[model samples]
Target chain A: MTASVLSRPRPAVATPTAAKPRRRLGPGRAIPFGAAIGPVGLLTLWAVGSAAGWLDPRTLSAPWTVVTTAGDLIANGRLQDNLAVSAQRAGLGLAFGTVIGTVLALASGLSRWGEAILDGPIQIKRAIPAVALIPLLILWLGIGEEMKVLTITLGVLVPVYIHTHNGLRTIDSRYVELGESLRLPPGTFLRRIVLPGALPGFLLGMRFAVVGAWLSLVVVEQINSTSGIGYMMDLARQYGQTDVIIVGLVLYGLLGLISDGAVRLVQRKALSWRRTLAD
Target chain B: MATHAGGLTATRTVRVRSLSRGFGDRTVLNGLDLEIGEGEFVALLGRSGSGKSTLLRALAGLDRDVAGSGQIEVPQNSSVVFQDARLLPWQRILDNVTLGLRGPEAPQRGRAALAEVGLAGRERAWPNELSGGEQQRVALARALVSEPELLLADEPFGALDALTRLRMHHLLRELCTRHRPAVLLVTHDVDEAVTLADRVLLIDEGRIRVDLTIDLPAPRSHRQPQFLAYRESLLQSLGVYQTEG
Candidate 1:
């Protein structure tokens, strides 16, 4: 061999080319206060527009006026009272919807008989928008708390049922074999395999459920209501108190954002095992 | 139990008689009969759709889908190691090994089994944290944790790399020597059969085409004449799990 050939560096790494393993991206960390960037930018735009006389308070209230109005409402306790009522309504509806969705998902997901009995009707319910039922609900319940709460519950449950049922159906068949080979008891199998297998789907559904709750809440509370953030906004509409309407909108936005964040935090903790560590 | 020429009786741990399984119009296991003596190691070799996995599944009592009729006598205390580790990804390693095991000593037994597979301190790690070979080791630990009377493996090392498969063969031999469970390893590798099994059964057309006994020692060299002789003989059953047209 020539001296040049002998002196040539061997291939940089002598690793086998067969069976390429996926490169891990390593641990991921979100930037501090990254989520505030968009809202802050929007606030700055609104503040600048109102300060420069580009925005009319009649058309869209200035951001500072809305903030001041919020502070005034808090000082006089109107914000607190309406917020409490809104929170209570949302909380009750969320609990009822989540529980019903979970129970129905279990009933349909686990057995053929259960699926036959429950899946079709639930799927049909899923096809129809919850808001479309409001007129019928108003006729029956007379636009009371009953109608509003039920609307929220209906909106929240469909996504939960859909995602949970999908998760149950898609559990790996290999795990089922493993369960059988291990001879796991019914209780252990349900707790260890079935529940965990469906958890990701349940969490995914909750993400949609929270949004659904808020969307339905907005609709129901605006319809001749005496309480809630939506009611306050509607009341402001009558006298052109645009600042109070803006305040109500801000509260709704914050509530929706915070509730979603809360569910995401739970998801992170519950699914921490799914994150692959540095290899 | 059957007596040998030397007057030693062999206690059969498994006995399958006239088993026939079919899917639609095609039969996979047709009148298959087999027996495994106590503590004996057997390897089964076959092509794709040649009834190898069918036989293993039947013995594992996971043959609910296949239509079959036969008497299968398998011990209640049995464990299986599949090609994939099939470890629950959400569970820690120790919990995976100890799954379905009962009593107070279960955790301790799980630890010892993990230690036996040379994964002493990895009990808390997730299954995905380990390499493919290590995950297979965990599967082995899970299988042997219960001190089963019979161990059925369906290409347990088939998914590993060449080097990993070699290491696993040694680990399996060492574990088998210590635990002495009647093991039935199903694989497509002819060389693997000669290196591990006391007997290799070749199944074709849903029946035993050949039954070759390996008279070699533990950790048998693939290069040895006897080993190659065994491989050369069995290599006639070609196809890497290929299906018939």
Candidate 2:
């Protein structure tokens, strides 16, 4: 075992022989693409049941009716306006939460005094539900965009804070030693070592923060709002516009899928180094 | 290049004196003193827990816990390569080699070092993509690129397969010949020590037990009678070798 293993030098890495031309798989791509057929089939079954009078079309509107009502809402400009308002609220809230949470997490993760002063309060804040604070936020900030943004920010902050802190704390000690051995200045060390090392976890936390922002936006908008998708859904329910409600629901789901997909694309580009482990 | 940049002639000797270190309830080294000349390769060979690593760390100024009076003055700062590669997982291959350099010409120097280690084309590869031997080479490149006056290596090639280990030993010798850093290598392998070092110092029970200087030429044969005799002497001094009747 020893002699044979020791005798062989490392094999040379195979060089690429040629650049293969790209081939288009337009029709051939349809098989793996059709893997989504199961969810589409379920939606069709629901729509058929509702249309054939076996189900209440009033509550569970047929797919075609939902689509038509969505088109009407879009034509009237109400859907776009509501969507813009909700998106603004979620975007602002996520920005606020991410900035504040990341700063606090870095301070706590690196300094003993910061952790001592902040950990107790952070633990208490994490234990309480963000939705339960709606009444208090409304009392303080009034029933307006401030209240909605505050609620969403509160929801997003805790997860980002936890994940960022954990990420910073978990950087390998060897890296710190390496920096020390090099005699790098403090600012250079933090910039080159600490920030880059903690990035993957910090970005992961931001993704969770984005999702939390949407969830909190729904609850906040439902509670009180003049505009936004959740408020539109509430308005539709009062008038018993079941199709309009379904339209609003479908739009919300689509917005969520798009937001999550955007985060995933960013993750792929930033963390291509992580692909080997994923495989 | 061996001359100081300020036009002052570089000091040629490394002076380490009265070094001591210990953890709570366990003393590792006591009052160790040694002076190494410039361009010297000294191998510290010993059993595990025999204070070889501790002494190396103390000499490198990595152990702040030791309560002892030791003055080590070299022309420039020291660099260490541990048993593990300790390469940053995020950085590309060339970046790992350039890790500690703090000047404008770092990338060019890094490429030169990588080329010296026979890893010229792998600069853009990720750390995980490289084999174990390649990773060790990167670690060596990182240590060597600084052109440190003193290099402290603690079993740096311990994880390599024997053939790779032999190649790495040869590479170290070649680099030392050109750059001429005073290197102190700690290893458990006796043949490795006998081949690589101009001098071998065996540390045991927190003290230097054996100090011998070899006048053999570079690329000396392991099969030579003198080489075998020195190997036997070292093995016997470590109390691990039994002769045939």
Candidate 3:
């Protein structure tokens, strides 16, 4: 969790000119602008080619078609309901994964005995493909919401656990010396030194967990679901409703974008110390 | 153990008898004996691989493997300042200054410490935001914040440029005079040792090779011929010849 790379100081801001207006663009500016470039260019090319009949419309629907269909889905209240279901599953799974992963990682990092007990088991489990566990999870939990949540939890836990453990283990030895020299109590050391030291890594793990939760939710929902975005995609695929599939894909991408944005915001707030170092 | 049990105005604030230390098979300090009196500033000079650092570490109680059952009974704990500032990178300047304090009451104490170190306006600045000299000051503030009865500095200003080092030496002398802690500074600079220390202890081949007292006034300048004479002698003891000007 001590991946210090992400918080690297941004390059110095460009100097202002009298003819040019300026606005503050800190870290998040790069993300949205960078993300917009590819999709916006692709959409522009598609719209121009399709309108000029250089591209086939019968098979490949236009951007307007995707947008209109999204409207239709929303009008029926189906999109909101499905989004609500997917969010519920992902939220619960993330809560479970982060809590358990952090606790286990701390134990492994702090104690040799805990590492001995956990290392092999965690290694073996990490290699087990999350998708392959779907059948086992279904058989054990009967394809209920619990199974979906558990699947997402499994998908999210390893990265969080490994990152957290590494972060905790890799703290500078000098901090430990400082603790000893100061004669800090065990609880105070853990709280004041260990936890803050591990925070950068922990936040990175949460970012990974958010993305993992989304990926796991889609896969889990595809297997068996009464209501969710993935379920809608599955139903549309059976009926050759490729347009619906496109809509669902767009929604999923947007959900990922939004969640990642949220996580980055939290990262900035937690690491506001970075602002002081920026030139 | 370099602590001594002598009363006020004791012959030595610290005394080490048959002290030895090693890491596994590599012995750093070999049966070294030393003594330092109250109100005395002793500079320990050595080559890179010599045991000067080990000796300082032992005096600070940072080394558990020091040989011999010697006694160290200082009035209180010794404050240590290391080579690299070693300030917690995540902490603000003020917070770093108060790094030794135990509780929530440390903020006010931290600010006061920063003010004492001439860094009053930088309380909220992060460690990386400070210049090299400023960072060293933060480290000094942290060491001095607790009002330690003894100060152990292991090349604390080794990373600084010459001018900055001079300023720091004066600041250190002023602070030591004000606080009057028995100071043991380890340095490779011959002039620095002769200028700042009331006494200089030269460690070579894991033993004290020379112990010479420097009789100079407070805030002694390098321009004084007497100071230069002592510097030349100490440099000669280290096998360096003073160039005739």
Model 1 over residues B164-212: C-alpha lDDT tens digits?
9999999999999999999999999888888999989999998888888
Ranking by TM-score: 1, 2, 3
TM-score of 3: 0.86
Order candidates by lDDT, high to low.
1, 2, 3
What TM-score does model 1 achieve against the real structure? Answer: 0.89
Worst 10 residues of 1 chain B by lDDT: B236-245
Question: What tens-digit string does per-residue lDDT give for candidate 1 at A1-279?
Answer: 799999998898887967996777965676799878988899899999999999999989888888889999999999999999988888888989999998899889999999999999998998988778999999999988999899999888899999998989899989998999999999889888998999989999999899788888889999869999899999999999999998988788888888899999998888877873421
Q: Give the Å error, residue A203, model 1.
A: 0.1
DockQ score for candidate 2: 0.31
Q: Write the per-residue lDDT of candidate 2 for residues A1-279, one digit (tens) a residue.
A: 999999988769976757976677655434665857987899989977977888787667788888888899999999999999999999999999988888989899889999999877988988888878888988999998888888888888888888888888999988887787776688877876788788788878877888888888889888878899999999999999998888877777777777777877887777666655445
Give the C-alpha miss distance for residue A243 in model 1, angstroms.
1.0
Docking class of 1: medium
Compose the digit string of candidate 3's lDDT tens values, residues B1-245: 23435433444567777777776677777778887777679999987888899888788777764553445555456788889888777777886777667777788887887888789999989888888999999898888888777788999999999899988988888888887778899999988898899889999877899988888876688888889988877777776654642
> Between 1 and 2, whose DockQ is larger?
1
Q: Alpha carbon lDDT of residue A114, candidate 1? A: 97
Which number leads on TM-score?
Answer: 1
- Which pairs clash inside model 1? none
* Cα distance off (Å), candidate 1, residue A18: 26
